[model samples]
Target: MKKFLSALFSLCLVFALVACGSSGGGEASGGESEETFLSIGTGGTGGAWYAIMSAAGAALNSDLNLDVQATGGSIENMKLVTNQSADLGFASPDTAYFAYEGGREFDNANPDLRVVMAGNMMYEYIIVRADSDIHEMEDINGKTVSIGAPGSATDIVGNEVLSSLGVEPAETINLAHSEAATALQEGTVDVMMALSGVPFTAATELSTVEDVRFIPLNQNEIDTVVENNQYWSGGELPAETYEGQNQPIPGINVGSLVIADESASEDDIYNLLNTLLVENHDEWEKGHNLASDFTIEMMETYVENGVVLLPFHPGAEKFFEEQGVTLNK
Candidate 1:
């Protein structure tokens, strides 16, 4: 029933976007500028993906003569971009890989998908009660857990990490980050897994409200996990992201990328890429702290084991190659 409702919601969003696409004539703020029209689909309205990409779209409108519309987040963005209802979208590279390869939720591969720029998700977190017996990633086995909302970036990665660790709980719950935290406090689930920036609010709130201790992936465990998933890297979650968390939590660093639809002309993609990656990076940083860490070298390193989730649009390829960098699949 929940799956049906979720699919219905997506279809409704796509149908509404189709209407917006047909009405056309969306322009930059003033009537004076005849800009190149484009749309970027991000997550919900208040989240980081939405806020940063909304700012990015706005900046593209004012400076690049591009009329940009910010739509929904990763999943909606994927649907919109694949159908050409939206020109660009943001998604975790791993989830994007799943989408393009027909590996996870996708029924058919999105052949038109292509990656542009990538950014890091600060850490991957697994949390349990302070007094709980689960002290490490392996301890999660046989426990009840909430793996994050169905179809969310966290859910996708959470499942993948569990698979890599060879750990599966006796039961699983699917809820959004906040709801999952609530469920944990209410004793509905025994553990919570999240992939987010440090001091993840929901996890932190749980700490303030409940006596909790984060489960860490020891160095050997990190090695084992990353050995199977190149998209993951061992990292420290930093101390004090939450109360009683005086030591860094061992976790993974993953990349989230901006991808484009093939239906967007090559020139449009090139222009947008150049404007964002080179000319307007500073403007983006003012709004998204993640942008500050985005560099060509980091972009080069994010792709894993020569397997790309989405192919690069010719335009993005051109820009990067001109910079003497080449991305491979």
Candidate 2:
């Protein structure tokens, strides 16, 4: 009799668990799907990518009832999304394109990669103390220069530009943005290349302590770089970007494409993007200055800017199409 009671109790417990599940989830709750948890991969701390994406993720989490986390930057972000460690990523178009094609730094093709949004970024320059005598791109030939850290967008772009310019600095130090800026201020490094939106925090801060000057690339130099490399757009750094700067400086600007993994559901991607652009526009702006530049037009015209070499995700494609914006596949 005792054994019979135990078996009956076990059956009842299993039934209760099933009942609980039926009442709580899996199409039983008004046929609505369960909330999804997501992660966004961003750049390192104190950078524009991290600042912008973190703000967007927070806004999505609150308004859409989703769990979202922001971590890492550029190349790291691409890996995180490809490996399914992150559902979304913010990266330069060149980096993502290389990953998709199995070229450049990556050996494997990630054909499943797709873009969600295209955002703005500007050309950063090789910074030096204004008082110093390093005047042009060729001036740094025999000086100590800190290239950006490996696996960084800055490193990739800077290396290409330097090689094209035929610059072989006396010493090439690999340092992150902040460290390179600090070293420049301390006179430990003669120059450092930065590639981000204008008024980069570290470079601006460095300007405050020392009148920093950016090495300007002339139109011929710009044409030379873009002749074989179409990933960049030729532009000028507007005035007042840094201390004691009153004139625009010629440079190359490239934008970034925010992408997502293919495994994510269309509904979730649609909802998250809709929440980001429509509902939380103002809130997301609190994250960075470039937040105001996130618009449908950017994504639509990205190919013209050479900022998008990959196709958009189906969900994103549908959303844009609804607004009469026909993207290039």
Query: lDDT of model 1 at residue 276?
Result: 70
Worst 10 residues of 1 by lDDT: 63-72
Error of 2 at 73 (Å): 4.0
User: How many clashing residue pairs, candidate 1?
Assistant: 4
Candidate 1 residues lying further than 4 Å off, grouped into runs, are 1-31, 35-37, 44-48, 55-77, 199-201, 204-211, 303-309
Q: Please, what are the lDDT tens digits per residue for candidate 1 over residues 235-303?
A: 988888788888887878766787887667787878877777788878877766656656676677765
Give per-residue CA lDDT, model 2, range 1-329, as digits (tens): 99999999999999998787677544545566666666777654545666666667667653244334434346777887889888888778889898777778787889999988877765757788888898888898999987776677787788888888898899988787778888998899999887777756777777888878888998888888877577777888888878888889998887888888777778778887777777777877776667777877777688555567788888888888886776776
In angstroms, the error of model 2 at 79 is: 2.1
Clashing pairs in 1: 42-72, 42-73, 43-73, 306-329
TM-score of each: 0.76, 0.88
